[model samples]
Target chain A: MSVLEISELTKSYPVPGGGEPRRVTVVDVPRFVVSAGEQVALEGPSGSGKTTLLHLIAGIVAPTSGRIVVAGHDMTALGEAARDKVRARHIGYVFQTFNLLQGCTALENVAMGMAFGTGVEAGRARELLERVGLADRADFLPRQLSSGQQQRVAVARALANRPALVLADEPTGNLDRRRAREALALMREVCAESGAALLLVSHDHDILSQFGRVETMAAINRAFATADGNSPVETR
Target chain B: MSRVPHHPVALLVRRSLRQHALSSAVTMAAVALAVGLVMSVFSIKDQARNAFTGGTMGFDAVLGARGSPLQLVLNAVFHLETSPGNIPWSLYEEIRRDPRVALAVPFALGDNYHGFRLVGTTEKLFADFEYRKGRRFEVEPGGRMFDPTRREAVVGSYAARRTGLRVGSTFQPFHGLFFDPDTQHEEEFTVVGVLKPTNSPSDRVIWIPIEGVYRMEGHVLRGSGEVYTPSPHEEIPDEHKEVSAVMLKLRSPAAGMALNQTVNRQGTVATLAWPIAQVMADLFERIGWAHRILTLVAYLVVAVAAGTILASITNTINERRREFAILRALGARRRTVFGTIVAEAAALAGLGSLAGYVVYLAIVATAAVIVRAQTGVVLDVLAWHPVLVAAPAGMTLLGALAGVLPAFKAYATDVASNLAPAS
Candidate 1:
């Protein structure tokens, strides 16, 4: 069964000031699908609309025109609140910066991943932390952990709610070469172990070489990879 | 899905309070201080009024030489203020014989022992009069009422405690209201009894027989000198006898009113203070501005404390935008984010309000001592009052109200942008 399916998804943003009245289309994906238990690497340089595509799939930002179904829920048709619920119940995201809550323990951060979903499942959080080789470090806060360890905790959090799909955007961007390889291996191995599909985006060729299946932004999205998606969007 | 916390917002708020312990404590302490002050002002004001009026517990009216009725009540009943001079002893006999009167106790004042008043009354005051409803003047187990014919006295409980004068103690009376070494009388009076604490102005007095006051060597009546001590065979003339004030308890409320009209309007000798509670309540009404000013100041402190809550939360909100964004990314709704901010404020105020009672107790305990010293009314610091419950609850509600501004700021937080690396 497919965990993620996107068809003719496009996101366009209007220019900053209203003078010439031009709109930039950041994401124009004709079709995309990731079956359960599949791990695919998406390769893209900076400002190539890779993050925008991930945002659309995650329902963090709405698509200008198209349908996105994640774990059988229609992401495009849902309101922001409903979309948030869908994302919480179906998708887990791992940002490059290890966005763990600074004030919470590793265990607490994992629990927070399940906060909006199943209330909180402490035993499951502990089990995931133990699986990530951070059982002894569950009480430690984010600042107390090393960069590799933080990413490990983030991976644990991503799989906390038993998500159907995991979207990792440059997950190993800050790690050294060996740590990056190890982090990627652990993330992909966990996704496979948990029967969740993994779609990881990275710019490094070395990182993409490890994946059995890989595709570049130009191949998936037909839009020009020019605008770095930091501005407001307007659907035309 | 946690260790039974039930909600992450509360858990997050608890952690945030610990993280910013200093600012949290400062804001909470401000809230606690305001709650304490507001509660204390209402408590002490109410207690003082009750004690002042309650001092007239068993008496129906006060009759003194023509003077301000308030002054007469204060002077005779409370041992406060100066005596409004003296009325003839015949007037006391006339009131005592009146059919409307049930009990009449005469007091002659004008002397002191170390600033404690010396009231001259018959032994009937200790044996028959009730200082409070159904509670008579109780002397210590080994003590007795002062001997009416001898130079003996009964020390009130507070006067005994303050001056260390117990039974068998002796002291010379001063000729004036204030204790003066030069004005000390040559005559010595024995302390034969010590009355128990009545928690009224009566507790601050030294009681002697009326004969001692009238025949005290230098006491002159109608310029008669009366220099020598009266013999057992020779009695003071009825025409020369005088009394300062008479405390009356009438048979009925109507009788009190009739006597008040007759003595105050028809006759010209004495003023009658009927309905003693009203006299005290009127006094509070006259000085009501002070109570209002205190209440206003307490409310102002609460407003300032609420401002601190606003400033404190707003300051932290700016730094924690990413934190909130992270929660949004974690799938927390905007309402959850809003609830978290409000809960933090309410938690601070609620915790502070709980601690406010401690502050209130400390303040009232300190004020109670001062009040008891100034006016012998023992304030019950631990007594329950409506303000006790209202102040803290109001503070917490106000705290939640204060959080609305910052909660809105948090609710409008841009998750997509704030989630971006702030570099």
Candidate 2:
């Protein structure tokens, strides 16, 4: 079963200047799917609508026209609040900078993921911290943790509610190469363990080499396909 | 019992408070100060009203030379203001001998030892006057009231403690309402006794025989040295003698009304003030504007405190946009985000109000000491009033109201832009 399904999805923001003839389309995905528990990589250069597509899939922004089904919830059919609920119960987001709340401990950051959805369970938060191998650092704030450790906490928090999908937008973009590799391995393993599909968006070629299956934005986004006229990239 | 888990808003609020500890503390301190001032004003007002209106200091009416009835009560009963003018001793005698009069204590005030007033009256005044309900003047152990015709003085409890005058301490009278070194009388009066604590205005006075005031050398009798007797201890004649005011306790309320009608409405010589508590109440009512201004100033402080919260939080919203957006991306609703800010304001105000009682106690305790020192009125510092409940609730509500504009600003933060990658 597909944890995420997208069809004919596109997003557009108005041109900065006020005019009737305006609105620049950023995302134009023809079709996409990520099966439950699968780990997929999306590779594209910066400003190529890679982030916009991810946001569309996460329902962070409404699609100008199309359907996005996150887990079992029809993202396009829901309001902003309902979309938030979908994001809470199904999709876990990991930002590039590992945006752990500055004041909260690693365990509290994990518990906070559950706070808006199910209620906070301290024992469960501790379990996630332990699973992420930060058991001894449960009480340490994000700043206290190393870059790799902060990413690891972000991974634990993403999987905190055991969501159906984890949307990671360059989760290791701020880390060293070794830390990035380790962070990638940890996120994939954790996503696999929790049976949550992973769609990791990154522009780095070396990072794309690690995934079993990878899809380039040049292929999936018809907006990019039409604009660049580039053939689909390699996929396995 | 199991401890309930904190809600997401509470969790966020708790963590944010820790994150912004300094700004939060400053805002709360401002609120505490405002709340403290407001509570103190209200407490003092209620206590003052109680002190002034609750007991008439055991008198039913005051008869003095024609003037403001309140002035008559002030000088005669409270030993406060100067008597309007001195009524003839003949008028005092007529009131004293009336069947309607249960007891008449005539006061003659013209001197002070330090700041405490010296009131010259008969020993019968101390023996019969009730300072509170069922409470009479009590002399300290091994002491007694002054002799009726001697220059001896009975020091009040507060006077004894303040002036360090005891049963045998002697001090010359300063012959005026205020103490003046140059106007000191030649005759020295010995402290024959000391009265126990009365917690009334009387506790701040020195008592001597009326005849002593009449014979104090500078006090001219009948506009000449009309010697009733060659000896200084002899009685001064009625035509020559004068009393500042007479505090009268009536046999019945009907007698008081009858006297009020005759002396106040019909007679021309003296002013009659009846139902002494009402007279005191009227005095408070006249000065009530000052109390209102104090209360208005307190509320203004509350407004400024609320404004501080608003400005502080609104300023924070600029820095916290990302955090709120991140919360939105985490599945927290807009109202949840809005409630986080509102709840923080209310929490700050609530904490301030709790601390405000500490501030209030400090203020009231200081006022209590000063009042006890000057007027012998004991203020109950820790006494609870309705404003204690209403003030905190009102301030917190005001705090919540203050947070609304900032909460709106926070609520409008777009999740997609704010939660996007920093790179």
Go through the candidates in order and give each one's DockQ.
0.42, 0.42
Against the true structure, whose TM-score is highest? 1
Residue B104 shift from truth in candidate 1, angstroms: 0.8
The regions of model 1 sitting more than 4 angstroms off are: A225-236, B1-4, B179-182, B216-234
Question: In candidate 2, which residue pairs get closer than 3 Å at backbone N, Cα or C atoms, i.e. clash?
Answer: none
All models, RMSD in angstroms = 3.0, 3.5
lDDT (10s digit) by residue, model 2, range B51-133: 87787378889898898998888787777777688878888889999999999989888888887888999977878888777
Clashing pairs in 1: A119-B1, A120-B1, A121-B1
Classified by CAPRI criteria, candidate 1 counts as acceptable
* Model 2 chain A: worst 10 consecutive residues (lDDT sum): A227-236
